[model samples]
Target: MKSFFSNQFINKTSLILLSLFSFSLTSCLDKEGEAPEPTPVAYVTLYHGAPDAPEFDILVDNQRLNSQPFKYNNYSDYLRFSTGSRKFKFTPVNAANSYVDTTLTFKENKLYSVFAVNRLQDMEVLVVSDTVMTPAAGKAGMRIIHLSPDAPAVDVATTGTTGTSITTNLNFKEHTLFKDVATGNQTIQIKRTGTNEVLLTLSDVALTAGKSYSLLLRGFQTPPTGNTNILSGQVVTNY
Candidate 1:
């Protein structure tokens, strides 16, 4: 009778221990089934000049983001970016005098604004894009302008073998325009009809097939003593 009681007790104890172990294993498996959450990212926007003041070029770091054909009263001249700390520089292409280069340390997911002094009309930048194409295929292009505070609208004409004529009119602001062009190395000359000034001359521009290029044109400034014209603008390429 004693042996039989001992055996039954041992069996019950073993079963209880096995059940507890199984419960622990099931709990662990349930915990392992869950997925981890993703980390958040930031967004940034950059604007040139004061919010109420007129500006020509909007850049995110060294990259030329937007140029205005006329003075936009709203948020049209802003560039957006993902969140993080970034360093930026803003240079006025068409200012009367060479302004000090401005730089900013930016935070992700935030908005910033910079300003230009001694404004000149028709400031812009050029960019190139990467869309694969054959040399014999068509081309892509972009246009830009700089508008002065009270200058008249300027007309643009493009003389190149690859792209169409850029006849867009720009007011007192910076404008970045885009278009499709032919593929090859090309020379482009931009002339202002009223002043008959060859505002810009770009030579040996490598325009690839199926790619987009941006051309930035800031305003022109006259010499201090004479009536001669001096060109001041910035150009950049983007893929």
Candidate 2:
């Protein structure tokens, strides 16, 4: 009978230990499952705003984007990358030195535009956060970026019946807020601030509904080389 009681005590202790071990394992698994996931990636689009800068390749964190070099006023589609401090290197094709080597930290769940601006010898990157929300029906969002280093402040007005000033006094390297406007092929003009002299006239440019766009005024008023009238404009779809 003593041996039987001893066996029973041993069995009960073993069962208790087994239950405790199982509970502990399950608790550990539950904790692991409840842990948060890593942060999501951010999106970035690149634009070459340096009029005199040569075609160059982009390397993000030492990874080359493509073999083809990006040229003046050229833009890239939004690309996905992780949120953190990132190194962007623009190496000129057939050249000994890099055009721009800059580092910037980015936030998650956001869109950005990185501009390679200024002269080739004094190149820099200008980062702009973009809004990609869909606009209301029959309306599109438009914004302006003035990257022409030597140009004066300007205003944008729509041509035709809607010939009204949309933005005013946008200085060099400045940008305007995105505003809603009627959609479809529209003619627009850029003029000097407080003056009637038109600098550029863009006609039949398609502005689709539920989208956002950025009109970038790049190049220089008096270019160092090449064409004397170097001021130019390009459009980018932000959404």
Candidate 3:
């Protein structure tokens, strides 16, 4: 009877240990099958005009990314992105002679930059992207530049689904630049400072996520003639 009791106790202990081992193994297997979070990618792009135009210096978030001119035209000049947000500034060797500087923004998985020159009296910047469109966010990422031989006052206004206006006075022969715009559809209205007379108005503008745009406004006001303005091409996106 003593031997049988000992044997029974040993069997129960062995069964309990086996069950514990099985449970641990199952738990480890479940953990192995669990999905992991995806890693974020930085999407960086450069948007500049003059595809046929000469290549110039490029600075990303104040860091020199490219010193030489890009090899392709407008479409090919844009850079591909990977991940992270970046601030970019492109200045041509002869900015005064060149049409304009390259303006763009770098955001996670999305980056766009565009460069163009001023031909007419007006200049414009068009923001385009494939990401979602949020007006407030889009406008926060945009920037604009105004150059004039004679420093003339400038004013900015948004005319679209939302009408927002801003005005500023520019010094003579001064170049004005505005930055940090939100994402969405809007317009920029430029007028001479101290005067209600409209100097230039950019309409049907689209601001997109992960993208950047630049505009060059040249020419100053003359006795009767107002300031010369330039308008950017349309910014199209799936959003």
Candidate number with greatest TM-score = 2
Q: What is the per-residue lDDT of model 1 for residues 95-154, given as tens digits with 9 covering 90 to 100?
A: 433223343443433433333423334322211222322222465564554533433455
Lowest summed lDDT over 10 consecutive residues: which window, candidate 2? 1-10
Model 2 misplaced stretches (Cα beyond 4 Å): 1-39, 94-96, 227-229
lDDT-sorted candidate list, best first: 2, 3, 1
On the 0 to 100 scale, the lDDT of residue 43 in model 2 is: 77
Please give, for residues 142-233, the per-residue lDDT of candidate 3 as tens digits: 33444443436676666656565443675432332334455566677777687888777777577666554444444433422442222222
The regions of model 1 sitting more than 4 angstroms off are 1-137, 145-152, 160-163, 193-197, 223-229
RMSD of 3: 21.5
Each model's lDDT comes to 0.41, 0.75, 0.43
Best of the candidates, lDDT: 2
Better of 1 and 2 by lDDT: 2
lDDT of 2 by residue, 193-238 (tens): 9999998888887999888888889888888856443887777777
